[model samples]
Target: MVKKSVRNKAISSVLGTVIVLAITIALGGLLYAYSQGMFSNLTQNTNINVQAKIIVNPSTNDSYLQLTLVNNGNLGINITKVTIDSNGISIPINVYLPPGQQYSNTFPLTSKMIAGETYTVTVYGNSNNKPVVETMNVLASTV
Candidate 1:
């Protein structure tokens, strides 16, 4: 029988190892990039809480809309505008609130509100140079 040639065995083994190492490095890079984006988004989330109600004054039988805003995020936010959907009214405001702080105010309603009725209030603002909106459904009640 003719002798088997082994001259190319070492070269083949080296080539195969290089290909596997290249593939492993490429996969590792992709995994690292994906994880970086996920962590960044988690750290940059915004959280704002809103509470609203229609308050009726017992003494005068007058009605008003009350709003309470709480900033629970890591950045400060500015209250730029507010809208009462039922009355088709928009109120422009400029209020700055820092994290862990709150702001509350009451606005007189043009018309009286019926008790047990629901109303919609929308608040618009900016936080960290990004627009933010919070909508709340409020029920009319007497104090």
Candidate 2:
């Protein structure tokens, strides 16, 4: 009588197929996430134009800043931050505006504002975590 020994493998053909398919699906998912980030970056890098005006309330003896943002790009934008600075004074604001939409905001003055002074206003926009910046010069009322 002759004795024969058989070896058993851990992974069969079907199990190997399943493992390959799982790895392929995981790699595909990772690639999709990476491409999404890249596309979002491309979309956010856009040209943004914002118009600003500074008005002083003579009746109230106070001054305020006004801004009109026009979204002329093809993509929608979300306003993230608005800042005004003059003579080392900084004012920060939060605003949201959409594409092809017009929005305005009035920022009150905390200190005495002088006439004929120049103020810089910066607006920041985001589209899919991408940033867009627009800066404008606002001259105070010389009245």
Candidate 3:
């Protein structure tokens, strides 16, 4: 009878340890999954795409600077200004673009554009109160 009681106590002790270990592993896995989702939601970013070109009118030979802005992020961006390197001029404008949307407009250039010349155009904007700037180099072409 003494030997049988000892054997039963040993079995119960082993079963209790197994149950605690299993519970610990399951809790650890659940915590890892929850933290992954929480951190991903906190780390979001804004992305803006910029494109520019010098468009020359075929009939009148007048050149104009065309700008195309695209918001490819999950946020909205407000365009505040644009600067052209060829003339060293900055134009102030107010334009708002939502996510997955595009804005395109042409501005008249005071100076004539020479074909095959490259120009640098810079765009300034804000998204979520953060300043954003995008610059692109484009060749002058007639259209």
- Relative to the true structure, candidate 1 reaches a TM of 0.65
Model 1, 28-55: lDDT tens per residue? 9988987876444346555789988888
Off by over 4 Å in 2: 1-45, 58-60, 87-94
Q: Estimate each model's TM-score.
A: 0.65, 0.58, 0.68
Cα lDDT tens digits for candidate 2, 1-143: 98788788588889999999999999999889878774554454355678777777666768777777877765677787777765454555556556567777777767666667788878877876788788888888833
lDDT of 3 by residue, 1-143 (tens): 45654433355778999999999999999889778764443566678888888887768878888888888877889999998787786878899999889999989886777777888889999988999888888888888
Q: Which stretches of candidate 1 lie over 4 Å from their true place?
A: 1-42
lDDT of each: 0.84, 0.72, 0.84
Model 1 lDDT, full chain set: 0.84
Instruction: Please give the range of 10 consecutive residues that has the lowest summed lDDT in model 3.
Output: 1-10
Rank candidates by TM-score, best first: 3, 1, 2
Better of 2 and 3 by TM-score: 3
Give residue 68's error in model 1 in angstroms: 1.3
